[model samples]
Each structure stands twice: as structure tokens, then as C-alpha cells.
Target: MCGIVTAIATNNVVPVLLEGLRKLEYRGYDSAGLAVLAGELTRLRSCGRVAELAALADARQLSAHIGIAHTRWATHGVPSERNAHPHISGGLAVVHNGIIENFESIKADLQGKGYVFESETDTEAIAHLVHYKLQANTDLFEAVRQATNELVGAYAIGVVAEADPFRVIVARRGSPLLLGIGEDGMYAASDTAALLQVTRKIVYLEDGDLAELRRDSYIVIRSDGSPVEREVHISSLSADAVELGKFRHYMQKEIFEQPQALAQTLELIAGGAGITPQHFGARAGEVFDGVRRVLVLACGTSYHAGLVARYWIESIAKLPVTVEIASEYRYRESVPDPDTLVVVISQSGETADTLAALKHAKALGMQRTLAICNVPESAIVRETALRFITRAGPEIGVASTKAFTTQLAAFALLTLALAKINGRLSAEDEERRLAALRHLPVAVQKVLELEPEIEQWAQRFAGKEHALFLGRGSHWPIAMEGALKLKEISYIHAEAYAAGELKHGPLALVDKDMPVIAVSPADELLEKLKSNLQEVRARGGELYVFADAGSEIPESEGVHILHMPEHYGMLSPVLHVIPLQLLSYHAALVKGTDVDKPRNLAKSVTVE
Candidate 1:
């Protein structure tokens, strides 16, 4: 979970590298540093945010036209100045994202060869490896190729050499990296946002691919160093994609845009001419035909999406589904037969844990793999046999909003496809469900109208130190996601519970000082949720709810209600989530927290 940016140009590159790091700090910010190919022997590295590091570098007068920068999320070592990236060895310095699983062995080998390491990071091993390789051969590209062949595990690496001065070598194994072709220079970044300020023309690095960047040009090659042709994909993302628009914060804009995002996603899945029910249904059916079990693997918000998917699969597909957090999934010894299908969900399609989990599942001889991702060309999408993309556009906010709704929409569609494949749903049932899915966008639009009320409610609850979110059935995961969003962006101590579980333990935490936000949509569990709300109210917990528009729940009783739009069974979670997102956004806004870039959290987890 770190960010890497490299620029190769004839002009000054330090400022460009710094600007790119600022845009990419959402990826990681525990520590930041840059290695520049200044004069013949100048390189600077410091710790902290890019601003602080840049100030230190300025004092050192390190300048260069070819450089690499990194914003690190501590994984292999403590967050410290020396552990920060752009690690140096001889005249070569490198910045890397992702973990090196075999670093200890490599470090021991290097130490036996009399190599001294200045940092405890796994990344320092690569710098020393390159330095060792270059001593035998001065060719930077050849050295990197030789050194990388000896390494194991996921990495997106960028390196610069003071000797070369004009070239940057970049490579990717199991992480995300992009090459941006600009008029002034060529760039390499871990994400598109970093290069958006320069150019929209980019070539995403495939696994085992390497790129050589120079001031005027760049070329792609395989791991073996043979020349390879590249396809340049123009990003459709506008500068506005990163803007807050009329909203107070990017989180707020994202919260309000949920309706449109959901609508667009529904249209893409249901109305897209190529996405026939037969295609998705037949594939899903064939995959799950005699499936003994299902495994859902994902990370962070996607893991919550998988939890909700488990509920859907078990209830509708009549198949048992196990949801595993990707980070923890591989460490376990449980194995699934070939009859099992593993579904991986991610928004960026490059989450390191999720990718590793997919690989682990494949290594276990499970061939049936499917991906639900937002980015169409992400690493997960390319590696999976089947893919479903969420049309959520670019979600720049560190804490996801639109991506969550779009993922839910994709999961709901997958449920229908599964039902159709298994013959569990009749034509009439399928049509009814499809009709409900079709209406979700409108329902989401209505929920977006609750923002003003939610903002006011956020004002009331802004000063509270802790809050609890409660829901039942499918809404349970929605409650969990809502709580996660609040705690992620606002730094609030928020917890989620199944409404029925409140009395079991969480009820003890309820008090007037702790506001309880309950998702009480009109469903079979509405009455049960209402009773749970009453229990919280009895315990002096202030109640705030987003309830169905015509629900029989009391509008008085000191309860603050934001009327929710009507939705059919199982679809209410998608609509009900909007207000909770808004509540968190506004609460963070009122608290004056950095809603977009929360502390100690990265937008994407690229390193384990």
C-alpha cells in the first residue's frame, strides 16, 4: 500500500515527481522520499509527507531530470526516515510498491557478498541487488532484469541511475503500474491520478512486463527483455473526475452522486446490448452447475460486498458460500475442490491481497474464477476467467462511496444470473427481480434527496465520540459498510451490529452520548428492527433512522427519521446506504477532518 512515481525527461523532474506524489498520497502516506539523478553523485531521501521531504531535499539542493519518488505505507519495517523509499545502492536508487516475500534470503545472500543495508525495508534489498548486478555489468536495464529474476513476490518497481541520467527502468510483477506518454516527458506511476496532470495517454503494465522510459520516448518489453509492442489506452477521466464539484468535499459529492452512479451501473448491466442474461446466466450456471461450495474473496469494502454476496448466494442460489478476507484467506489451510467457484471482488482490480488470494485459490486447483471489479482493464480483470465490471467511474475519495453502491448493484445482478443458471428463479420471478433492479436507480435518486436531512442529523451527532449502526438481514452488511465508511473517513469510533444482536452485547455500549443510527427499511425484518430500536431507546441511546417512507414506525418519540424511498426485497440495502454515506460525509465535514484523505489509510492496498 504505497505509491510510486517516476519521471524521465530532459527538463527538471523533481517538481513533477513531487506534484505526482501529492496527488498519489491517497495511496500511502506513512513516509515519503525521492531519489533524483542529480549531477553525478547526488541523491536525496527523507521521511514524512512529500511536502516535508521536499523541504529537506531542497536544503540538500538535489535536482535532476530523471528521478523516482515514493510515498510509503509501512509493511516490512517501521515508519522512519531511513526506512522511507527511493532506497540507494551505489549510484542506483529504486522506489518500489508491494512486498518482497523472499527478501530475508536475498538479504542474507547480499550480506554474505559484503553488501551493507542502510534500511530495514525489503525494498533496500532490490537496490543492493541492482548495485551488485551493475558492478558486473554497467547496463542498468540488463542489471534490473537480472536482479528482478532472482526476486520473488509482488512488486511494481521504478529505478533511476545517476550513470544513465536519461532513462528510468520500470517493471511490474503482481502490482499496478502505468506508463504515461507526455509531450514534455514520459512518466510512470502506480495509479492514473498521478499522471492525470500530465497526460491521459497511458499504457498499463501487465504482469511480467518492463518499461524503459526516456525524455522523448518509452518502450515496453517482456521480463526476458525482448521488445514488446504496447497499446495506449486513453483515460476517459476528466479533471472533473477528481473535483468536488458543488459539494463541500469529494466525499459529499460522491455521496450525492450515488443515485446517478447506481443508475449508470444498472443501465450498464441490464441495458447493455452485449450483456444478455443468457451470457451471464449460462456462464454462472455452468460454473456453479454442480458446485459443492462457493468461496468469495475480497479486501476492505469489497470484502463487505462479498459478505452481502454470501447472503445472496446462500439464499437464492441455494449454494453455500464462504466469504474470506483476502489478506487472511491464503494463510488458512482449507482447500476447495474443483467443483467450487471462487468469486473475487474489487473496485480498482489491483488490490494486492485480493490478487494474492486469487492466486492462492488457483494454486489449490480451483479453476473456476470470476472477478467483479470496476476498472475494466485492471490486473484482476485480466487474470480472471470471467469478469463483471462496475460502471462507478473513477472513485478518487479514499473511502469509497459510488464504488460500494455499484458493487452492490453488480452483486445483485450476479444473484439474478445465478438464479437463472440454476433454474431456481422462474421467468416471472426473474422479470420481477429485473424490474426491481431497473427501478433501483430511481430509488437511489430518491434516497439522495435525504442528504439535506442527513446533513442536519450529522450536525446533531457531530460532537458524539461514538456511534452504533444497526440493521438486519442483508442490511447487516450495509450497516457494517456504513460504520466502516464513518470510521474510515471521519475517524469516529463507529460500530455495526445486527439489530437482533444488540441485546447480546452491543446494547451495553448504548448511552445518550452515543448516537445509534439504525437502517430500518420496510422489509420482513422491519418489525424486528423496530423492536431493536426501542431497546436502544430504552437504554437512553439517541436514535436516528432512515426508514421506509410509509412505515408505521412512530415519527415522534424523539426519533429523527429520514424517509427512504420504496424498494423491493433485497434491493433496499442499495438505496438505504446513500443516507448513511451522506451522514458520514457530513459528519466528517462538520468535524473539519480531511474527508478525502483520512489519516493512516490508503485508497488502495498494494502491499501486504
Candidate 2:
């Protein structure tokens, strides 16, 4: 996924474009570029973060009242200045996101017309095509529309012209683009986060929509050339929430923000003694009543949260639950039930595969849908019938922390609501769980105090080449999440196996050099998990156990134990993941890897 920001304002837009790119850099950070129309088109591009490109613009004193910018996560080409966004041709500059599928044929046709390419990107082809279209028509917006007609894939494009210095043309097809209307300016960007500093009111452009932006106002047109109006919603995200105040990195800030995230997510039921489907949304009661089963779709860390929700849903709601990786869900042939509740979870609602899976489920006649997301006006949130916004704030780190825990909190609320509606949970039981939900913030805060001990364990883990994570029952998914966090940030080769499956085959890989991290909370599965640790020790494997305070797991010659302050029961996964997240962060910090922006990993996977 790449990010695009366009602004036409009373004041110079160079600072606005740079600030917008900085806010949206979490979406994509491989390269950054901008096209500003001063007396003529001034195109500047770079192969790194937004700050680098901003420095270049500053040195050159690039200034304009109208402009478009892009921070890219490269798709068709490598991260280089030539392959960066703001691809320019004669009299036109274009910045694009998503794939321009069939660009090779378009490139060949453009080359035959004596238009040579500058970069290896499919975007260069679109730039030349737009310039070619402008030759037949004098209108910039008309040329952008004609070029979009020639393209065959997804795009959110911003086009500016040197001849039409005060105008910007934006178009979107199957990608995210939104317009912000302000008294002094008009803006368009890939996300609302970039526009929050200037405007809170936004109009989200639908698929196959085009817009013409000028200094004072904007006009929207549908793909068929008819004038249209989109709804404008007020955003709740504050500019202060996205800022990293004193935290060293976004990962660390998000990890510590868990307590507040849980507190806010659970605030509606803090002192309540009951749960109902209305907790999710106004129409959740009607939707939950028709739901016969549950199907969850997610990717990456969100999928692990879905897995943990599976256990909660099946056991508490007395309904069968199925979890699938969103990417694989659409490719396979499977039976879809119209009565099933399709739950899609994503931190950024723009995740491409998850959105595709939601559409597939809807296409298969599943009308009951719910999106657990962080962004309010994203694609998945707009598409779903009901939604639960996690309110974890802007998660800038590639590795998710607060979003995962907040999703779990939301899923726990979902479980309680479903259980109460199905008569599986009595009013008293519901009240008890409600109280536990309210105390989740305190519980997680207690767990966060163990960071010093976890840092010690991280010192041992950072030097290891490979590691294993073990858990049983509900905690198995937590183990998987821990392993994922470790590998994602620290670059350590790690794997997770259910503790019961240790003897089957994984034991052979355990040796003195390999460290096995075990989740040994005081649940019913703890005894069996202890036996699994013994098997690891017998194989000359070093054991690292994250146990409850009095679980009787002692630190021995080959056994290293770090006890959690208390047992959290059903909510233990939320607390357990904190240390693992800290361990990964510290490990990466010690290893001198990029902690915030991990190599080859972006915050959101908006492309297929």
C-alpha cells in the first residue's frame, strides 16, 4: 500500500503536502515524492522516508499553492528515486497507488507513439497515457478520466498540471481515497489521518468516482460523468493521539497504551451488570438473532486474535466458529451459510485480502456481517452491516500491539453479548464477566510492570538463532502471536506448536542451543504444559516459562521462569502478549534492527 495526499489551499501547499505525507507514512514508507505547480511543475522524488524527501524540498525552497504527494510501498518496481511516485510526463504529473494491471500493453502502445518511459513502474505508463489523452482534449480532468477508462485495475490517483496550475484531479477505483473540505482549502488523501490536522469533516470517495479540487471547493463526478454527492462524516481521531510524545518508538508507545486502549474499549460496560448485542451497534441485536454460526476473516496478527476469539465464541456462545486467513478464504471453494455471522477484523479497514474476503462472503448471500476495525470510515467498516471500532488510536508500528489487545477486548465483549442473547450466560455470570472486562485495564497494567524481567529474558533470546513457543488451550493462539512478534521484529527464526504436540515431532529439533518459551498459566492445561517443558529439558533444550505467580515452576539449571503477577483466567492472553511484545521490542532494540519500520513489512497490507 502507498499513500497519496493532495491539497489546494490559500497558503502555500508545500508544507501541507509534506505534513500529510508524514502523517500517512505508516501506510507506506519505501519512497516519497511530490509534484508542486509553482510557475511550472516542480517534481521532487526520493527513495526513502518522507523526512528525506521533505529535506530535499526544503533545500530547493519548493513552494506552491496547489500540489499532490505520495509516500510509496513499491509494487511494480524497486525502491529508487526513478521508481518513486509523482511520475511526470509532458505538462502533467501523476501519483498513484494500487496496480495498473495491463500496463505493459499500454506501455508498448505509448512507446509506439514515441513516448519513452523513465521508470520501470506501471505508473509511468499511466502518466504518458494521461499526457497523450490531454493532446486530444484540453481539459485536465477529462484527460484523467479518459486515462482511468484505459486502465484495468485498482488505483487512487492524483493528477496535477502545469498549464492548469490551480487544479487537481483525483480518481479512485477499488482503492481508498477521501476528500476533506475546509473553508480555506480542499484536500484529498488515501486516509483521513493525513487530513485531521486541517479538517475533521471528510467525504469518502466510492469506487469508480472522480473529483476536481481547487482552492475553495471541490466537485464530485461519478464514472458515467453525472454529478454526484457523497456523505460527509466527522472524524473522531485527534491530532494529538497519533503523535509519539516521549516514547522512543511507536511499538513501545503502543505497548504501553494498552491499558488506556482496554479502558476505552471496555468503558461502555464498566459498571454494568449485563450484556446485549446492542453493545456493538444499534442493529446488532437484530443481526445476532439471525446468526446461526460465525465465520471470522483476518490476516497476520489479526488472524491470531480471531483464533483466540474462536475459542471464546464456541465455548461461551455455544456456536460453532471458524477462522480463516483472509487471503486463502476467497480462493477456495467452500459452503457459505446465509445465516452465518461474517466477522472481519483489521486494524486498518483497508486491508485488501480481508476486504476481498468480506465481499466474497457477501456475494455468497451472507447478509449478517460485522467489522471489528480501528479506522472508522475505512472500506471494511463502510461495507459491513455492523461494526465495533477498537479505538486503539493510530498504530504506526508494522508489528501490531494495542490493536491486537483491543481486538481481543472487542471480541470478548462480542462473546459476552452472544452468550447473554443465547441464554448460555445467566445474569449473574454476565455481571461477573462484565466486572472482569472492566478490570482488564488494571490487569494488563499489572502485567506491563514485568518489563524489566522480560528484558532480561530478551537478552538471552536475542543471541539465539531459533526459538520455540509453546502453549495449550486458549493460550495456544497467544503462543502463536508471541512467536510471530519475535520473528517479525527481532528477525529470529521462531515457531509455535501446541504443547500437546511437542512429542509428536518437534522434540527432535530441541537441543541445548534452542530456547523453548512456554506459556504456563494456572489453567487446567498447565500440568500438561509442564510435562511438555520436561520433554524439552530432557532433550537438552533450554526452557523459558512465563508462568503464574505460584505455579510452582522454579528456575533451575536449564529452566528459566518469569512469573506473571497473577492469573487472568479467560483474559490471560491479553496480559500474556504484553511481555512477548516487550521481549520482541527489546530484542530488536538490542539487535540494532529497525524497530518501528521493519524491513519488508509495512503497517497495512493494502495490496494483494
Candidate 3:
């Protein structure tokens, strides 16, 4: 994923462009650049963070009435000044997000036409193609639209033509782009957070929609050049929501926000006596009635949420569920039934692979669809028939914390709703389930209190190069999520295995130097999990167990116990994952690693 911000204003837009880039840096930070049109196209590129780019801009006294800026997560080329965005060809400067699958053929054609290519980026090809289109049509909007017609694959591009200095042409297909209406100017960005300071009114562009932006006005048109009206939504997000008030990093702020996040996500049920299917959407009860099975499509942390959902849906709803990684599922042939409900999970709801997979499922005649997402205006939310918007607002960390727990909270409600609809849940059981959900925030708050203890454990983990995470049943996915968090932030080589699978092969790697972290909930599998922990101890592996309160597990020389407040039956995964996240966060701190913007990772995966 990359971030793009464009502004056409009466006053100098250099400051606006720079501020927007700073807000959007979580999307990508490999390099940053800006292109402004004063008398001609003035371009500045940097292979550094936005701060360095700002320094360069100040040194050069860059100022313009219209400009576009980008912070990139490199795709087609390595991170360098030459590979940064604002890829220029003749008079056209283009900044883009998403992949161009047919770039090789397009690049060859452009090269054959005697056009010189500067950077090894697909984005450079778009600039040349738009410049080429300008020769036939003098209008910049028409040139961008015509050039896009010849290109394939996903793109959200902002183009500024030297001839049309006051105007910016933007187009989107399979990537997020939106226009912000401001009193002084018109703004376009991949995310609303970028333009929050300038505007609160946003117009989300549809696929293949091309827009021409100028000071105080913007016009949106369809691919066929037909004019259309897009509704402008009043954004609830404030500039303060993105600020890191007193926290060292956004990750820490988000970790503490889980209590409020969960509370807001579960607000509809917190005061209710029982749960209902209508909590999902107006048409959810009808959609759930037709669902005979469920197929979950997601990627990354969202995929792990889907894996945990599998156990809930099958056990509570008595529905067969298959969780598939969206990236893999979209490219493979699979059985798709119209009666099957396809549930897609994403924090941004603009995840490229998950969105493609949703379209793929719909193409195969699966009409029943649902989205569990954080953003209310995201593409995945609009594409699905039903949706549950998690209240985990603006997760800036590349490694998710509040978003994951909120997804689990949303999934728990979905499971209860389905169970109630199918008669699997009795009235008494439903009340009990609802009670557990109502107290989820309090339970999560109790878990947050254990952070100090977990931080102490992190000291032991920080110096280690490798670790193992073990759990059984539904907690297996929790273990996997734990391993992912540790590896992602701390750069530790970590792996997770179902406790039952330990004897199969993984037990061989256990030693005194290796830390074995176990999720030991007091369920029926606790004894078996204890045996797995013993297998590690027998081989001199240091065991760090997060056990249920009142569990028989004893603390000894190598066996360390961190007791959870309570053993939540089905909702344990949500609570158990908190300490693991804390451990990873503290471990990353101990190692002095970047916790928010981890290496080679962006917060959003908007590209394939």
C-alpha cells in the first residue's frame, strides 16, 4: 500500500501536501516525494521519510497552488530517489497506488514509441502513457481517462499536467480514492485521515470513476464520460483521533483503546437482554436464513480472525465453515454454493486480496455475503450485502491490536445471532452468552492490568532469537496470532503449533534456550496441553504459561505461570491474545525495534 495526497487550492498547497503525507505515512514510508505546478511541473523526490522530504522542500523553497504528494511502499522497484513517486514523463507527473499487471507490455509499447523511461516503476509507465494521451487530447481529464482505458489491473492515480497547471486529474479502480470538499480548496487522498485537517466532508469515488479537481470545485465522471453525482459523507473522524497523545507509539495507544473499542463495538448488545440478527444489518436476518454454510475470506491478521470464527460458527451455529486465506482462495478453483454465506474480514475493508476474493465468490454465484470491517466507508463494506463495522477506529500500527480483538468481538456476536436463529441456543444460554459479551470490555480491561508482568517476561524473550507458541482447540489460532505478533515487531523467529502436534515434529527443537509460550485455558484439553508443556520441560525448554485462574498448573524452576483473570469459555481467545500482544510490544521495545512501522510492512495491504 502507498499513500497519495493531492490539493488544488487558492493559496500555496505545499504545507497541506506535506501535512497530509505525514498523516498518511502509516500506509507507506519507504520513500516520499511531491510534485507541484507553478509555471511548470516542479518535482522533488526523496528516498527518505516524510520529514526528510519536508527538509528538502524547505531548502528549495517549494511552493505551488496545486500539488500531489506520495509516500510509497515500493512494489515495482527498490526504494531510491529514482524509484520514488511523482514519476514524470514530459509534462505529466503521476503518483499511484496498486499494481499494474500488464506494465511490461505497456512499457515495451511506450519504449518502442521512442519514449524514455526513467524509473523501474509501473507508475512511470502511467505517466508516459498519460503524456502520450495528451498529444491527441489537450484536456488533462480526458487524457487520464483515455490512458486508463488501455491499462489493466488496479490503480488509484493522481496526475498533474503542466498544460493544465491549476487542475488535478484522479482516477481509481480497485484501490481507495476519495475527494474532500474544503472551503479553500479541493483535496484528494487515499484515506480520509490525510485530509481531516482541511475537510470533514468526503466523497468516496467508485471503481473506474475519474475526477477533475480544481480550486473550490471537483467533477466526477464515469469511465464512459457520463457525469454522475456522488454523495458526500460527513466524516466522524477528528484530527485528534490520529494523534499519539501521551503514548510512545500508536501501537501502545491502540492496545489501551481495546476496552473502549470493544465497548463501542458491542454497544447494541450491552444493554439488551438478548442478541438478535438485526444487529448485523437490516437484511442480515434474511441473509442468515438462507445460509447453509460459511466460507470466510481474509488475509493477514484478518485471516487469523477468520480461523477463530471457524470454531465458533461450527460449534454454536452447527454450520460447516471453511476459512481460506483470501490471496490463495482467489486464484484457486473451489466449490461455491449460492446457499453458502461468504464472510469477508478486513480492518480497512480495502484489502486488495480480500476484495478480489469477495468479487470472485460473487462471480461464482455466491450472493449471500457479509463483511466484518472497521471502516464504515470502505469498498469491502459497500460491496458486501451485509456488514458489521467494528468500532476500532484508526489502527495506525502495522501489527493490529484493537482491530483483531474487535473482529473477534464482532464474530462472537455473529455466532450468537446464528445460533439463536437456528435454535441451537436456548433462551437461557442466549442470556448467558449476552452477559459474557456485555462484560467483554471489563474482562479485557482486567487483562490489560497484566501488562507489567508480561513486560517483565519480555525481558527474557528479547535476547532470544527464536520462540514457540502452543495452544489447543480454538486457542490454536490465538497462538498463531501471538507468534505472528512476536515475529512481526521483535524480528524474532517464532512458530506456533497445535499442542497435539508438538509430539509430531516440533518437540525436537525444544531446549533450555528456547522459550515455549503456552495458552492453557481450563478446558477439557488442559491436561493434554499440560502434557505438551511437560514434553518441552523434559527437554529443558523454559516454559512460560498463560494459564487460566485456578488451573492446577504450578510454578516451578522452569515453569512460569501468568494467570488470566478468568477462563472465558468461547471468548478466551479475545482475552488470551492481550498478554501475548503486550509481550511482543515490550520485547520489541527491549530490542529497540520500530514497533509501529515494522520493517517492510505497511498498515494497509491495498496492493496484490
Candidate 4:
């Protein structure tokens, strides 16, 4: 994901634009740039961070009443100052997020027209096309609207021009864009946090909505040239909430925010009223009552949440659920049951593959859809028939910590709700699950107290090249997630097995040098998992185990153990994941890898 911001104010907007880019640093950090209208379009760019771009703008005294800025996660071009953002052409500049699928063809068309390109970015194609339209039409908003029609891809754009220095034009097709309305100015940003400092009055721009922002006001128009009035939503996030206060990085801050985030997610259901399909949406009760089966589509960490939910839904709700990676699900042929409830999970809710899979399912006649997402107004939420917003606030970390836990928490509620609908949830079961849900935040908090212990294990992990993770049943997904976190942030080669599969194949790879990290929570599979650990021990594999207090597993003969105060039963995965996040954070710190922004990884995967 990339960040785009622009502002039109009665006074110089450079400060607000720079601050907006800074707030959006979590979205991207590869390169940043800004273009302003000070009698003429002046563009300043830097290769490293928004601070560098701010310094460059300061050096040139870049002051303007109208400006556009961008922080880029390189997609079509290399990450460099020359290819940063605000691609300028013919006195007009454009900042764009999302891929341009037809850029090569558009580039050829622009090149054939003798329009010289400066930056090797697909964004430059939009600038040239806007310039081309500006030549035929002098109206800035009309030119932008016309240019958008010729493009074929997902995009959120902010355009500024020397010809019309008092106004900024903005539009979005797939990526997010919002308008901030204040007394003296108007603003456009890719994130609400960017505008939280300027104005709490936020307006989410829908797909195909084009807006023109002037100093005092703004106007939004539909693709068909119809005037549209967008609803203004008052935002609740504060600047302090997103800042890394008393924390080393955004990832670390987000890891600890799990307790608060999960509390917010569970607040509505903590009253003992029990979960109902209405928690998803108003029509959810009707849909849930009709569907005979469930099909879940997701990717990465969100997919792991679905994997864990498969165990909960089948056992507790007695429902048949099929979990599929969204990208894979869209390409293959499947039996599309109209009675199936298709559920899509995403932290950003704008994942391209997940959105496409939701659409693919809808096209195949599965209209009963649900979205488990963090963002309230995202593409998946807009497309799906029902949705449950996971209140994880904003996860800045590239490797998900709180979002995954919150998703699992949402799944727990979903499973109980489904059981209630199917007549499988007894009054006693409801009381027990709701009590567990109410106590889950405190349970997660207790888990966070183990960070120092996890850090010690991370120190040992930092020296290892390969690791093995083992678990069983619901905890197997936790093991997979732990392995994913280590590999994603720390660059560690880690593998997870169902623990029973160890003797079948992965046992041959076990050695003393490769530390085996086992998730040995007190569960029904504890005996089988312990037998698997003996096989690892006999083969000279060193083991680090996280076990319940009464599990009887101890630190003896090359095995290291961390004892949990108590077992959380069905909700153990939520508690077990915190230490793994701590492990990844400290391990990445030891290995000196970029913890928040890992190599070749963007916080949001907007493209397929």
C-alpha cells in the first residue's frame, strides 16, 4: 500500500501535507515526494523517508496554498528519488496508489504522442493523460474525470496543477481515499489517521467517486457526472493512539495493544446477551438461518485465522466449513452451492485477491456473504452482504499480531452464533463461552507478561538458521502463525508440523542445531504431542516448549520449558500468539532486520 495526501487551504498547506505524509509512514517508507503550486508546480522528492522529503521541501522553501504528497511502496518502478511520486507532466502533477494494469499500453500511447516521461512509474501515465485532457479541456476537475475513464486498474489519486492552483482534484477506484472537511480548508488522504489531526469530520470516498477540493469547500461527483453528497463520519482515533510513545517501533506498540483492541472488539458481546447473527449485520440472521455450509476465503495471517475457525465451527457449531486461499479459490473450479455462506477475512479489507474471490463467489450464485475485517468502510465490506468489523484499531506491523487475534476472537463469536442458530448451543455452553470471551482480554494481558522470557528464547533463535514448530488440533494453526511471524520479520527458516507428521517426514530434518519450538498447551492431543517430542529428543533435537502449568513437561535433557499460569482451553491460541509475536520482534531486533517494514513486503497487498 502507498499513502497519498493533498490539501487546499487559505494559507500555505506545506506543513499539513508533510504531517499527513508522516502520519501515513506506516503505509509506506520506501520513498516520498510532494508537489505544490507556488505560481508554478514545484516537486521535491527523497529516497528514504517522509522526513527526508520534508527536509528537501524545507531546503527549497516549498510553500503553497495547494499541494499533493505521496509515500510510495514501489510497484511498477524501483524505489528511488527519481521514481518516488507526484509524477509531473505539462504543469500538472499526480500522486497515485495501486497498480496500473494497462500502463504499458498507456505508456506507448503517451510516448507515441511525443509526451516525454520523467519517472519510470505507471503514475506518470495518469499525469500525462491528465495533461492531454487538460489541453482539450481547461477545467481541472473535468480533465481528471476524463483521464480516469481511460485507465484500467485499481487507483486512488490526488492531482494538483499550476493551471488551477487554488484547488486539488481527487478520485479513487479501488484503493482508499477520504476527504477531511475543516472550517478553513479541505483535505484528501489515503488514511483517516492522516486527517485526524486536521479534522475529525471525515468523508469516505466510494469507488468511482471523483472530488474537487477548494480551500473552503469540496464537491463530489459520480462517474456518470451526477452530483453526489457523501456522508461525513466523525472519526474517533486520536494522534496519541497511533504514535509510538514509549515504544521502539509501530510493530512493538501494536503487539502490546492486543489487550485494548480485543477488549473493544468484545465490548458489545460482554453483556451476557450471547452472540447472534445480528452481530455481523441486520440481514445476517436471515442469511445464517438459510445457509447449510460455509466457505471461507482469505490469505496470509487472515487465512490462518480461518484455519483455526474450521476447528471451532466443526466441533462447536457442527458445521461443515471449507477454507480456501482466495487467489487459489478464484482460479480453480469448485462446486458452488447457493446455500453456502461465503465468508472473506482481511485485516485491511482491501486485499485484491480476497475481494476478487468474494466477487467470484457472488458470480457463481453464492449471494450470502460475510466479511470479517478491521476497516469499517472497505471494498470487501461494501461488497459483502454481512460484515463484522474487528476493532483492532490500526495494525502498522507488516506481520500481523493483533489483527490475527481479533479475527480469531470474531470467529469464536461467529461459531457460537452459528451454534445458537443450529440449536447446538445449550444455555450452559453459551454461559461458559461468554464468560471465557469476557475474560479473554485479561488472559491476553497475562500472556504479555511473558515477553522477557520470550525475548530470552529469541536471543537463542537469533543464532539459529532453521527451526521447527509443532502443535496439534486448534493449536496447529498457532504453530503455523508462529513460524510465519519468525520467517516474515526475522528472516528465519521455520517449518510447522501437526506434530503427528513429525515421524512421517520432518523428523529426518531434526538435529541439535535446529531448535524445535513446540506449542504444548494442555489439550486432548497432549499425549500424542508428547510422544512426538520424544522422537525429536531421541534424534538429538533441542526443544523450546510453551506448555500449561500442569502439563508435566519440564526443562530436562536438552529441552527448555516456559510454563503458562493456567490453560485457556478453547481460547488458548489467542494467549499463545503473544509470545510468538514477542519472539519475532526480539529475533528481528537481534538479526537487525527491518521489524515494521520487512524486505519485499508491504503492509497491505492491494495487487494480486
Highest TM-score against the true fold, candidate: 3
lDDT of each: 0.83, 0.90, 0.93, 0.90
Worst 10 residues of 4 by lDDT: 268-277
Highest-lDDT candidate: 3
Model 3 TM-score relative to the real fold: 0.99
In the range 1-608, model 3's lDDT, one tens digit per residue, is 79999999998999999999999987757999999998988999888689999999999999899999999898898999999999998887999998999999999999999998888899999999999999999888998989999889999999998878878999999999999999999999999999998999999999989999989789999999999999999999999999999999999999999999999999988667468889889998899996899999999888889999999999999999999999999788898899998999999999999999999999999999999999998999999999999989999988999999999999999999988899899988998888998999999999999998999999998889999999999999999999999999999999999999999999999998889999999998998998888899999999999999977899999999999999999999999999999999999999999898898998889888
**Regions more than 4 Å wrong, model 1:** 44-48, 53-63, 269-293
lDDT of 1: 0.83
Using lDDT, rank the candidates from best to worst. Answer: 3, 4, 2, 1
Model 1, residue 591: distance off in Å is 2.3
- CA RMSD, predictions in order: 2.7, 1.5, 0.9, 1.3
- Rank candidates, TM-score, best first: 3, 4, 2, 1
Compared with the true structure, what per-residue lDDT tens digits does model 4 show for residues 125-212? 9999999989899999999999898889999999988878878999999888999998779999988888877898999999999999
- In candidate 4, stretches whose alpha carbon ends up further than 4 angstroms from where it belongs are none
How big is the positional error of residue 96 in model 3, measured in Å on the Cα after superposition?
0.5
Backbone clashes (count) for model 1: 1
lDDT of 4 at 195: 85
| lDDT by residue (tens digit), candidate 2, 18-132 | 9999988766478999999889888999887888998999999888899999988878988899999899999789999898889999999999999989899999998999999
Which portions of model 2 miss their true places by more than 4 Å? none
Model 4 quality (TM-score): 0.98
Model 4 per-residue lDDT at 204: 93
